[model samples]
Target chain A: MDHPITVDSDACTRCGICIEICPMGIIAQDGPDDLPGLVPGGAAVCSRCGHCEAVCPAGAVSARYPACGPQHLPGGSAAIAPADLAAYLRARRTVRRYREECVDRETVEALLDVVRFAPSGMNGQPVHWLVVHDPAEVRRLAGLAIAWMREASRAGHPMADLFGVLVRTWDAGVDQICRGAPHLVIAHADAKNPMAYTDSIIALTWLEVAAPSFGLGTCWAGFFQMAASASPALAEALGLPEGHAPQYAMALGYPAYRFPRVPGREPVRVTWR
Target chain B: MDHPITVDSDACTRCGICIEICPMGIIAQDGPDDLPGLVPGGAAVCSRCGHCEAVCPAGAVSARYPACGPQHLPGGSAAIAPADLAAYLRARRTVRRYREECVDRETVEALLDVVRFAPSGMNGQPVHWLVVHDPAEVRRLAGLAIAWMREASRAGHPMADLFGVLVRTWDAGVDQICRGAPHLVIAHADAKNPMAYTDSIIALTWLEVAAPSFGLGTCWAGFFQMAASASPALAEALGLPEGHAPQYAMALGYPAYRFPRVPGREPVRVTWR
Candidate 1:
């Protein structure tokens, strides 16, 4: 990983913008007019946040580690207006009931493509996704979650009462664990990676937030995540990548209903310093 | 707490949709055909997730807990298209250098308004905010973070080398901690609330993702967060609620430069089961 960054000297203006923009303070210039490069031993401590590449005014800097790709955006500061973006964010809802029709791979892949850009600590980008593409497999996972809850209820755990209710609800065939959604998307990472949990949740949040614009809906699968954390049976069934655990799970599908109105939330509390 | 949900009888069709839609399964109907209402002790168990309210075909069911508000989406599912939303999200770039202009109270409040709808654990919605509004105060906080880093560097901390570099960078007059942004937004919550950390980060992420639309920019103040977590000097200066701790912080201000293209991220890795 020597010199994880490269400079297109053909386009370089020796402006030192990349050197100044490096979050790791790893890039350096030999003189005021010299082309910038990583200081000695820079790659070892580089956070891979890609600030150097993105901040290059001439597009002369490129970070090599993640494999950079070109992306075109609606130019200037007007991609979408403030009002429109606010409206879209406010309209997002935690979908409970999903249509039985299966979601296509291309649509789901598009979602992952958008989500891959979601931020991570030091740009570790450790999260990998597990999509339970088969609705039947999702159902099996939900059933295993219910099984864990029943055991917890029998053992009188701290949340035993709630578990009892969930178990009874499952018995009544409500499929509340996964909300009977046609698919489940789980973000997994090595348990050893300190950033894995927060990073995965952020990516999932981005996925859930962006899904609606894709003509899809998502719900945080809290029940399944709870069971997965402690239930070996459920974990074994999930068969996540070796050395990895599911950080969070999201119920993904086309929603069965449309929500035209955005519901209120608790009044925001703030302290101005 | 009784009857947290209300129904408009005129608008109600007795269609059994609300009864089936209640996530708590607390709504019930009587006889061959009956209007749905909360069963005995319904409100206590209600997750307040607003499924019944959002799922109603006639908009007859309203959850009193959240004080439901009328929100007009672009109408139908035609808000922003998938590709456009992805483009906008991808275009988001964290600001390291920002214009000196101060952010207005109205604009900050607007951002908070949109963020209030961000989902939380079981609708717990525990997060509150702290705005270090003055640029001078933001600088003070950044200096405090540097002070902490200096102390960490003095000791043989595992991250001592990185801290030493940051401390030297600070001594050389680069405000890397908060990036000299005009304002800092810190999400905080009661230490007892388990959902606080994740909820706060999600809300902050939403704020980061949507800032570009508002002609503003943000960077996760990871350095400030590091100091806030373990530095008594920083914590006392933050002056959060008595029972609360700062979950995460973001540096916010107008950008010094525009990012014309979306930078690439790591490849999307997925397992389909």
Candidate 2:
């Protein structure tokens, strides 16, 4: 069924571009008596290529792709390719333990190559990344983060439940959740710029998505990021610029465990209006 | 080619979770001398379901699906499938003009629904939204933005070239880009919160990815967002809370122009450690 590109008649300036650009010759003038409308009745068979979508200058048209969901990407491989998207999101777990092997610099670089393209607000492009490969340095940073979490937990902060789990794991002599992944990639951005964190996280998410493809595990290390903000010594050691602040950190490594089934979780709350 | 869940031996602490959870009988202790290595010649194929990822309390394991990129649940459809991660990244573009139709409330809600789940620093969840629906109000706000841009342009701001083009377009009887959209969604967070902008932006990116699938066009209206920040009257009208600051605004509608090819850009710089 073809749905005519719906436009607010009052808002339409008769740009006519929509009619000219429709790949399917379905859009046309409604004649002098009729307002501009689509031909072949109300339903227009749309290829869903989004050519009309990319061309409508008035920002008026809305196409409904019944099969498309909120996560669809226009012009990408699939707006919602089932295998890749599901596996990408489900595959990322907050990995904390690791084997002792070192991750080569080449692999880390390859991951960054993909992440470097993350969109920035106004293309401000304020985000920067720091890769820490020294094992000792990683441990030192992890120790500082653990110390912060321990103090917060002891002080009974509202997030103590999460921090408490971490402290207990640390006390149990389990490897640090960061698992001492030989490298720590820290994303930083201009603290004064409002969009820094968004840029950093987008890049980080890209890295997360790309990590599993490379057989590397990643755990978001918020504590380390916060530590960079809260402690000058940590920030200095990370070589952060004067106005730069760390937004997120990922501890990357290979997993030491495997489970057969997808883990259960509280269903995410999503309301369609 | 079954790899034994290669672990960074220096990074691992001999945690027994791998042995405890290996569904396949591939994992075993390599004698007391060889710190818990997986069998050298095992043919175990990782299901890559991320069960170990979820259960890895230490946050050490990372699994990458080579073909998939980041996965997200869009508007709560069954898990969105993944596509070629590289292809998806390559295909993303910055859309500007839009059509003349109004975006449905359901579409906006769906986008918000998906983006609302963006992780906040410490789960603060402090971000707020102001969805502008009134066409008249949208025009009024856009006029103010145009006024601001004109002033800045005359003052020879570095963006004068861009503003000149926008002004020229408006003078040529085309609707201002900011006013061209049927909906304006503004993201705000507490001004005092250093991470507010970052939080807002991550949420915005979520919306951006999810919008096109529903046949909606989105443009980053950073200048308008900035104008709102500068104009207290406008901010108050938008119902920004006393302490909250508007960080981003997006123009959403149908697209105005179509390009036959994805735009190419210079490669971004990325270095491996």
What TM-score goes with each of the models? 0.94, 0.58
The residue pairs that clash in candidate 1, if any, are none
At residue A53, candidate 1 shows an lDDT of 74
Write down the worst ten-residue block by lDDT for model 2 chain A. A264-273
DockQ of each: 0.61, 0.09
Q: Give per-residue CA lDDT, model 1, range A90-175, as digits (tens).
A: 88888888899999998999999999989888878899999999999999999999999999889988999988888887898888
lDDT tens per residue, model 2, B1-273? 645255555655666665555533345667643444446665344443334333445544444433212232234333222335554553454555567777777667656655554545544556778788766778777777666667778999887877777777677765544646777888777899977876677667656655655666677787687668765556666776688788788877876654433322223443224
Q: Residue A240, candidate 2: how far off, in angstroms? A: 6.9
Best by TM-score: 1
Q: Candidate 1, after superposition: displacement of residue A146 in Å?
A: 1.8
Which runs in model 1 stand beyond 4 Å of their true positions?
Answer: A74-78, B31-33, B74-78
DockQ result, candidate 1: 0.61
How well is each residue in A72-97 modelled by candidate 2, as lDDT tens digits? 23554534553334434443454555
Q: Please give the range of 10 consecutive residues that has the lowest summed lDDT in model 1 chain B.
A: B69-78
Alpha carbon lDDT of each predicted model: 0.85, 0.60
